[model samples]
Target: MRPKQVFVANHTSMIDFIILEQMTAFAAIMQKHPGWVGLLQTTILESLGCIWFNRTEVKDRVDASRKFREHAHGDDNNPLLIFSEGTCVNNEYIVMFKKSAFEIDVSVCPVAIKYNKIFVDAFWNSRKQSFTMHLLQLMTSWAVVCDVWYLEPQTIKPDETSIEFAERLMISHRAGLKMVPWDGYLKHSRATIL
Candidate 1:
Protein backbone atom coordinates (compact mmCIF):
# COMPACT_ATOMS: atom_id res chain seq x y z
CA MET A 1 0.00 0.00 0.00
CA ARG A 2 1.35 3.39 -0.96
CA PRO A 3 1.71 5.69 2.00
CA LYS A 4 0.09 8.74 0.44
CA GLN A 5 -2.15 7.29 -2.25
CA VAL A 6 -5.73 8.43 -2.75
CA PHE A 7 -8.17 5.61 -3.40
CA VAL A 8 -10.84 6.81 -5.83
CA ALA A 9 -13.89 4.64 -6.26
CA ASN A 10 -17.50 4.59 -7.45
CA HIS A 11 -19.94 5.15 -4.62
CA THR A 12 -22.50 2.43 -4.04
CA SER A 13 -23.68 2.38 -0.43
CA MET A 14 -22.75 3.67 3.01
CA ILE A 15 -21.50 0.14 3.58
CA ASP A 16 -18.75 0.82 1.07
CA PHE A 17 -16.76 2.73 3.66
CA ILE A 18 -17.36 0.09 6.31
CA ILE A 19 -16.16 -2.67 4.01
CA LEU A 20 -13.07 -0.75 2.99
CA GLU A 21 -12.26 0.17 6.56
CA GLN A 22 -12.43 -3.49 7.54
CA MET A 23 -9.86 -4.37 4.89
CA THR A 24 -7.41 -1.54 5.61
CA ALA A 25 -6.91 1.48 7.78
CA PHE A 26 -7.99 4.33 5.53
CA ALA A 27 -9.67 7.67 6.08
CA ALA A 28 -12.78 8.01 3.92
CA ILE A 29 -13.90 11.44 2.79
CA MET A 30 -17.67 11.83 3.04
CA GLN A 31 -20.13 14.58 2.22
CA LYS A 32 -21.44 16.49 5.22
CA HIS A 33 -25.20 16.60 5.43
CA PRO A 34 -27.30 17.75 8.36
CA GLY A 35 -29.45 14.65 8.46
CA TRP A 36 -26.76 12.14 9.38
CA VAL A 37 -24.05 14.27 10.94
CA GLY A 38 -24.98 13.67 14.56
CA LEU A 39 -25.35 9.94 14.17
CA LEU A 40 -22.06 9.64 12.30
CA GLN A 41 -20.19 11.82 14.75
CA THR A 42 -21.36 9.77 17.71
CA THR A 43 -20.52 6.50 16.03
CA ILE A 44 -17.33 5.04 14.53
CA LEU A 45 -16.97 7.73 11.86
CA GLU A 46 -14.94 10.03 14.05
CA SER A 47 -12.77 7.20 15.31
CA LEU A 48 -12.16 5.90 11.80
CA GLY A 49 -10.78 9.27 10.76
CA CYS A 50 -13.52 10.09 8.26
CA ILE A 51 -13.50 13.54 6.70
CA TRP A 52 -16.86 15.23 6.38
CA PHE A 53 -16.99 17.57 3.40
CA ASN A 54 -19.47 20.33 2.71
CA ARG A 55 -19.56 20.63 -1.05
CA THR A 56 -21.89 23.63 -1.28
CA GLU A 57 -19.77 26.29 0.39
CA VAL A 58 -16.44 27.42 -1.07
CA LYS A 59 -14.91 27.93 2.36
CA ASP A 60 -15.90 24.47 3.50
CA ARG A 61 -14.51 22.89 0.36
CA VAL A 62 -11.22 24.72 0.83
CA ASP A 63 -11.03 23.69 4.46
CA ALA A 64 -11.78 20.11 3.52
CA SER A 65 -8.98 20.14 0.93
CA ARG A 66 -6.56 21.46 3.51
CA LYS A 67 -7.59 18.82 6.05
CA PHE A 68 -7.32 16.14 3.39
CA ARG A 69 -3.83 17.30 2.45
CA GLU A 70 -2.78 17.38 6.06
CA HIS A 71 -4.08 13.90 6.70
CA ALA A 72 -2.54 12.57 3.49
CA HIS A 73 0.76 14.18 4.37
CA GLY A 74 0.68 13.38 8.06
CA ASP A 75 2.63 10.61 9.76
CA ASP A 76 -0.45 8.43 10.10
CA ASN A 77 -0.31 5.02 8.40
CA ASN A 78 -3.78 5.15 6.89
CA PRO A 79 -4.30 6.00 3.23
CA LEU A 80 -7.15 8.27 2.09
CA LEU A 81 -10.22 6.86 0.36
CA ILE A 82 -12.28 9.31 -1.68
CA PHE A 83 -15.51 8.39 -3.42
CA SER A 84 -14.95 10.69 -6.35
CA GLU A 85 -18.35 9.93 -7.83
CA GLY A 86 -19.53 12.31 -5.08
CA THR A 87 -22.73 10.38 -4.36
CA CYS A 88 -24.00 6.86 -4.23
CA VAL A 89 -26.08 5.46 -7.04
CA ASN A 90 -27.74 2.19 -7.86
CA ASN A 91 -25.30 -0.47 -8.97
CA GLU A 92 -26.45 0.07 -12.55
CA TYR A 93 -24.46 3.22 -13.23
CA ILE A 94 -21.56 5.43 -12.18
CA VAL A 95 -21.55 9.20 -12.24
CA MET A 96 -18.73 11.49 -13.31
CA PHE A 97 -15.99 11.75 -10.70
CA LYS A 98 -15.27 14.97 -8.85
CA LYS A 99 -11.80 16.30 -9.70
CA SER A 100 -10.65 17.09 -6.15
CA ALA A 101 -9.10 13.72 -5.45
CA PHE A 102 -7.30 13.78 -8.79
CA GLU A 103 -5.69 17.09 -7.88
CA ILE A 104 -3.82 15.52 -4.97
CA ASP A 105 -0.11 15.43 -5.78
CA VAL A 106 0.31 11.72 -5.23
CA SER A 107 -0.30 8.35 -6.74
CA VAL A 108 -3.97 7.49 -7.21
CA CYS A 109 -5.33 3.99 -6.71
CA PRO A 110 -8.56 3.38 -8.58
CA VAL A 111 -11.02 1.09 -6.81
CA ALA A 112 -14.18 -0.62 -8.03
CA ILE A 113 -16.94 -1.74 -5.69
CA LYS A 114 -19.94 -3.87 -6.65
CA TYR A 115 -22.76 -4.94 -4.37
CA ASN A 116 -24.99 -8.01 -4.72
CA LYS A 117 -28.49 -7.57 -3.39
CA ILE A 118 -29.40 -11.24 -3.11
CA PHE A 119 -30.84 -10.63 0.34
CA VAL A 120 -31.80 -6.94 0.19
CA ASP A 121 -31.38 -3.80 -1.86
CA ALA A 122 -28.26 -2.32 -0.33
CA PHE A 123 -28.24 0.79 -2.49
CA TRP A 124 -29.10 3.69 -0.20
CA ASN A 125 -31.68 5.86 -1.94
CA SER A 126 -30.72 9.01 -0.08
CA ARG A 127 -33.50 11.03 -1.67
CA LYS A 128 -36.48 8.92 -0.63
CA GLN A 129 -35.30 7.43 2.66
CA SER A 130 -33.24 8.64 5.55
CA PHE A 131 -29.81 7.17 6.27
CA THR A 132 -31.15 5.58 9.43
CA MET A 133 -33.97 3.97 7.49
CA HIS A 134 -31.64 2.56 4.88
CA LEU A 135 -29.28 1.37 7.58
CA LEU A 136 -32.10 -0.49 9.28
CA GLN A 137 -32.98 -2.03 5.93
CA LEU A 138 -29.45 -3.35 5.60
CA MET A 139 -29.39 -4.63 9.14
CA THR A 140 -32.62 -6.56 8.77
CA SER A 141 -31.54 -8.06 5.45
CA TRP A 142 -30.21 -11.60 5.25
CA ALA A 143 -26.96 -10.53 3.67
CA VAL A 144 -25.18 -7.82 1.71
CA VAL A 145 -22.46 -8.91 -0.70
CA CYS A 146 -19.53 -6.61 -1.28
CA ASP A 147 -16.91 -7.00 -4.00
CA VAL A 148 -13.97 -4.64 -3.96
CA TRP A 149 -11.06 -4.47 -6.38
CA TYR A 150 -7.92 -2.38 -6.04
CA LEU A 151 -6.53 -1.57 -9.45
CA GLU A 152 -3.03 -0.38 -10.20
CA PRO A 153 -1.78 2.92 -8.84
CA GLN A 154 -1.31 5.68 -11.36
CA THR A 155 0.73 8.86 -11.40
CA ILE A 156 -0.48 11.98 -13.16
CA LYS A 157 1.42 12.75 -16.33
CA PRO A 158 3.16 16.10 -16.37
CA ASP A 159 1.03 17.23 -19.28
CA GLU A 160 -2.28 15.94 -17.99
CA THR A 161 -4.78 18.06 -16.10
CA SER A 162 -6.56 16.75 -13.02
CA ILE A 163 -9.80 16.44 -14.95
CA GLU A 164 -8.12 14.31 -17.59
CA PHE A 165 -6.59 12.07 -14.93
CA ALA A 166 -9.95 11.76 -13.20
CA GLU A 167 -11.66 10.86 -16.48
CA ARG A 168 -9.10 8.16 -17.17
CA LEU A 169 -9.64 6.65 -13.73
CA MET A 170 -13.40 6.92 -14.14
CA ILE A 171 -13.18 4.91 -17.37
CA SER A 172 -11.21 2.22 -15.61
CA HIS A 173 -13.75 2.01 -12.78
CA ARG A 174 -16.66 1.85 -15.20
CA ALA A 175 -15.01 -0.92 -17.20
CA GLY A 176 -14.05 -2.89 -14.12
CA LEU A 177 -17.47 -2.69 -12.54
CA LYS A 178 -19.33 -3.12 -15.84
CA MET A 179 -21.25 0.03 -14.91
CA VAL A 180 -22.86 2.38 -17.40
CA PRO A 181 -21.82 6.03 -17.52
CA TRP A 182 -24.60 8.18 -16.07
CA ASP A 183 -25.06 11.55 -17.77
CA GLY A 184 -27.82 13.19 -15.77
CA TYR A 185 -27.12 16.53 -14.16
CA LEU A 186 -29.70 16.13 -11.42
CA LYS A 187 -28.86 14.03 -8.37
CA HIS A 188 -32.35 12.57 -8.14
CA SER A 189 -32.05 11.27 -11.69
CA ARG A 190 -29.27 8.86 -10.73
CA ALA A 191 -31.74 5.99 -10.60
CA THR A 192 -32.88 6.57 -14.16
CA ILE A 193 -32.36 3.69 -16.50
CA LEU A 194 -31.02 4.61 -19.89
Candidate 2:
Protein backbone atom coordinates (compact mmCIF):
# COMPACT_ATOMS: atom_id res chain seq x y z
CA MET A 1 0.00 0.00 0.00
CA ARG A 2 1.09 3.56 -0.66
CA PRO A 3 2.27 5.54 2.34
CA LYS A 4 -0.01 8.10 4.01
CA GLN A 5 0.12 11.51 2.32
CA VAL A 6 -0.66 14.89 3.89
CA PHE A 7 -1.32 17.64 1.38
CA VAL A 8 -1.01 21.30 2.43
CA ALA A 9 -2.26 24.24 0.43
CA ASN A 10 -2.36 28.05 0.38
CA HIS A 11 -5.99 29.10 0.71
CA THR A 12 -7.11 32.15 -1.30
CA SER A 13 -10.74 31.37 -1.93
CA MET A 14 -13.64 29.23 -0.68
CA ILE A 15 -13.31 27.11 -3.82
CA ASP A 16 -9.68 26.28 -3.09
CA PHE A 17 -10.75 23.02 -1.46
CA ILE A 18 -12.93 22.19 -4.46
CA ILE A 19 -9.98 22.73 -6.78
CA LEU A 20 -7.86 20.33 -4.77
CA GLU A 21 -10.79 17.89 -4.48
CA GLN A 22 -10.81 17.60 -8.27
CA MET A 23 -7.21 16.36 -8.22
CA THR A 24 -7.45 13.95 -5.29
CA ALA A 25 -10.18 12.45 -3.17
CA PHE A 26 -8.75 13.59 0.16
CA ALA A 27 -10.32 14.38 3.53
CA ALA A 28 -9.71 17.89 4.88
CA ILE A 29 -9.54 19.88 8.14
CA MET A 30 -11.58 23.02 7.76
CA GLN A 31 -13.31 25.81 9.68
CA LYS A 32 -17.00 25.33 10.38
CA HIS A 33 -18.53 27.35 7.58
CA PRO A 34 -21.88 29.14 8.14
CA GLY A 35 -25.44 28.99 6.78
CA TRP A 36 -26.00 26.77 3.71
CA VAL A 37 -22.29 26.11 3.61
CA GLY A 38 -22.42 24.80 7.18
CA LEU A 39 -25.23 22.47 6.11
CA LEU A 40 -22.98 21.03 3.43
CA GLN A 41 -20.13 20.82 5.92
CA THR A 42 -22.30 18.73 8.25
CA THR A 43 -23.70 16.55 5.48
CA ILE A 44 -21.63 16.08 2.31
CA LEU A 45 -18.26 17.19 3.66
CA GLU A 46 -18.60 15.08 6.79
CA SER A 47 -19.47 12.06 4.67
CA LEU A 48 -16.28 12.68 2.71
CA GLY A 49 -14.36 12.57 6.01
CA CYS A 50 -13.82 16.28 6.41
CA ILE A 51 -13.20 17.49 9.97
CA TRP A 52 -14.68 20.81 11.00
CA PHE A 53 -13.75 23.01 13.94
CA ASN A 54 -14.79 26.39 15.26
CA ARG A 55 -11.75 28.64 14.99
CA THR A 56 -12.98 30.75 17.89
CA GLU A 57 -13.17 27.85 20.30
CA VAL A 58 -10.04 26.47 21.93
CA LYS A 59 -11.77 23.22 22.79
CA ASP A 60 -12.94 22.69 19.23
CA ARG A 61 -9.43 23.34 17.96
CA VAL A 62 -7.97 20.81 20.37
CA ASP A 63 -10.58 18.21 19.52
CA ALA A 64 -10.10 18.74 15.81
CA SER A 65 -6.35 18.32 16.15
CA ARG A 66 -6.83 15.03 17.95
CA LYS A 67 -9.20 13.82 15.24
CA PHE A 68 -6.81 15.06 12.54
CA ARG A 69 -3.92 13.05 13.91
CA GLU A 70 -6.09 9.95 14.18
CA HIS A 71 -7.22 10.22 10.59
CA ALA A 72 -3.73 10.98 9.36
CA HIS A 73 -2.42 7.71 10.77
CA GLY A 74 -5.54 5.67 10.07
CA ASP A 75 -6.15 3.08 7.34
CA ASP A 76 -8.04 5.49 5.10
CA ASN A 77 -6.75 5.72 1.53
CA ASN A 78 -7.58 9.39 1.12
CA PRO A 79 -4.81 11.84 1.87
CA LEU A 80 -5.30 14.62 4.44
CA LEU A 81 -5.65 18.05 2.86
CA ILE A 82 -4.86 20.96 5.19
CA PHE A 83 -4.95 24.65 4.48
CA SER A 84 -1.95 25.34 6.67
CA GLU A 85 -2.53 29.07 6.46
CA GLY A 86 -5.63 28.43 8.60
CA THR A 87 -7.64 30.98 6.65
CA CYS A 88 -8.02 32.42 3.16
CA VAL A 89 -5.83 35.31 2.05
CA ASN A 90 -6.25 37.86 -0.74
CA ASN A 91 -4.24 35.64 -3.16
CA GLU A 92 -1.67 38.46 -3.44
CA TYR A 93 0.34 37.11 -0.53
CA ILE A 94 0.56 33.97 1.62
CA VAL A 95 0.24 34.26 5.37
CA MET A 96 2.14 32.24 7.98
CA PHE A 97 1.38 28.53 8.09
CA LYS A 98 0.24 26.77 11.25
CA LYS A 99 2.69 24.10 12.38
CA SER A 100 0.15 21.42 13.26
CA ALA A 101 0.47 19.66 9.93
CA PHE A 102 4.22 19.58 10.29
CA GLU A 103 3.98 18.37 13.88
CA ILE A 104 2.86 15.00 12.56
CA ASP A 105 5.73 12.71 11.57
CA VAL A 106 4.31 12.20 8.06
CA SER A 107 5.61 13.90 4.94
CA VAL A 108 3.68 16.83 3.46
CA CYS A 109 3.05 17.75 -0.18
CA PRO A 110 2.74 21.48 -0.86
CA VAL A 111 0.10 22.85 -3.22
CA ALA A 112 0.13 26.46 -4.39
CA ILE A 113 -2.90 28.23 -5.84
CA LYS A 114 -2.95 31.65 -7.48
CA TYR A 115 -5.87 33.37 -9.12
CA ASN A 116 -5.81 35.82 -12.02
CA LYS A 117 -7.57 39.02 -11.06
CA ILE A 118 -8.23 40.24 -14.59
CA PHE A 119 -11.43 38.27 -14.81
CA VAL A 120 -12.40 38.36 -11.14
CA ASP A 121 -11.05 38.59 -7.61
CA ALA A 122 -11.43 35.14 -6.09
CA PHE A 123 -10.55 35.96 -2.49
CA TRP A 124 -13.63 35.45 -0.30
CA ASN A 125 -12.81 37.94 2.55
CA SER A 126 -15.32 36.22 4.85
CA ARG A 127 -15.31 39.16 7.31
CA LYS A 128 -16.83 41.31 4.59
CA GLN A 129 -18.98 38.85 2.67
CA SER A 130 -20.95 35.63 3.01
CA PHE A 131 -20.23 32.40 1.14
CA THR A 132 -23.42 32.75 -0.89
CA MET A 133 -22.49 36.30 -1.76
CA HIS A 134 -19.03 35.15 -2.78
CA LEU A 135 -20.54 32.44 -4.99
CA LEU A 136 -22.92 34.91 -6.55
CA GLN A 137 -20.00 37.20 -7.35
CA LEU A 138 -18.14 34.34 -8.97
CA MET A 139 -21.15 33.26 -10.98
CA THR A 140 -21.71 36.77 -12.25
CA SER A 141 -18.09 37.35 -13.15
CA TRP A 142 -16.74 36.90 -16.64
CA ALA A 143 -14.61 33.96 -15.57
CA VAL A 144 -12.40 32.74 -12.76
CA VAL A 145 -8.85 31.94 -13.74
CA CYS A 146 -6.60 30.01 -11.38
CA ASP A 147 -3.35 28.11 -11.38
CA VAL A 148 -2.58 25.19 -9.06
CA TRP A 149 0.83 23.66 -8.52
CA TYR A 150 1.51 20.44 -6.70
CA LEU A 151 5.05 20.88 -5.48
CA GLU A 152 7.54 18.31 -4.26
CA PRO A 153 6.79 16.67 -0.95
CA GLN A 154 8.51 17.82 2.26
CA THR A 155 9.45 16.04 5.45
CA ILE A 156 10.86 17.31 8.70
CA LYS A 157 14.59 16.78 8.88
CA PRO A 158 15.97 14.66 11.71
CA ASP A 159 16.97 17.80 13.62
CA GLU A 160 14.17 20.10 12.53
CA THR A 161 11.36 21.36 14.73
CA SER A 162 7.77 21.38 13.47
CA ILE A 163 7.79 25.18 13.27
CA GLU A 164 10.90 25.12 11.12
CA PHE A 165 9.42 22.45 8.91
CA ALA A 166 6.30 24.55 8.52
CA GLU A 167 8.44 27.54 7.63
CA ARG A 168 10.21 25.51 4.99
CA LEU A 169 6.88 24.59 3.42
CA MET A 170 5.91 28.26 3.57
CA ILE A 171 9.08 29.11 1.66
CA SER A 172 8.14 26.59 -1.01
CA HIS A 173 4.72 28.22 -1.25
CA ARG A 174 6.33 31.68 -1.40
CA ALA A 175 8.31 30.59 -4.43
CA GLY A 176 5.04 30.80 -6.36
CA LEU A 177 3.28 33.45 -4.24
CA LYS A 178 4.43 36.43 -2.19
CA MET A 179 4.83 35.85 1.57
CA VAL A 180 3.64 37.92 4.51
CA PRO A 181 4.83 37.05 8.01
CA TRP A 182 1.40 37.59 9.56
CA ASP A 183 -0.27 34.55 11.04
CA GLY A 184 -3.72 34.06 9.54
CA TYR A 185 -5.12 33.98 13.09
CA LEU A 186 -5.09 37.76 13.29
CA LYS A 187 -7.68 37.84 10.56
CA HIS A 188 -9.85 35.45 12.51
CA SER A 189 -9.54 37.61 15.64
CA ARG A 190 -10.62 40.68 13.73
CA ALA A 191 -13.51 38.82 12.19
CA THR A 192 -14.65 37.73 15.62
CA ILE A 193 -14.47 41.27 16.91
CA LEU A 194 -16.56 42.77 14.12
Maximum-lDDT candidate: 2
The TM-scores, one per candidate, come to 0.83, 0.89
Candidate 2 lDDT over 141-167, as tens digits, reads 999998887778988899998877877
Instruction: Give residue 13's lDDT in candidate 1 (0 to 100).
Output: 83
Q: lDDT, candidate 1, residue 170?
A: 52
Q: Candidate 2, clashing residue pairs?
A: none
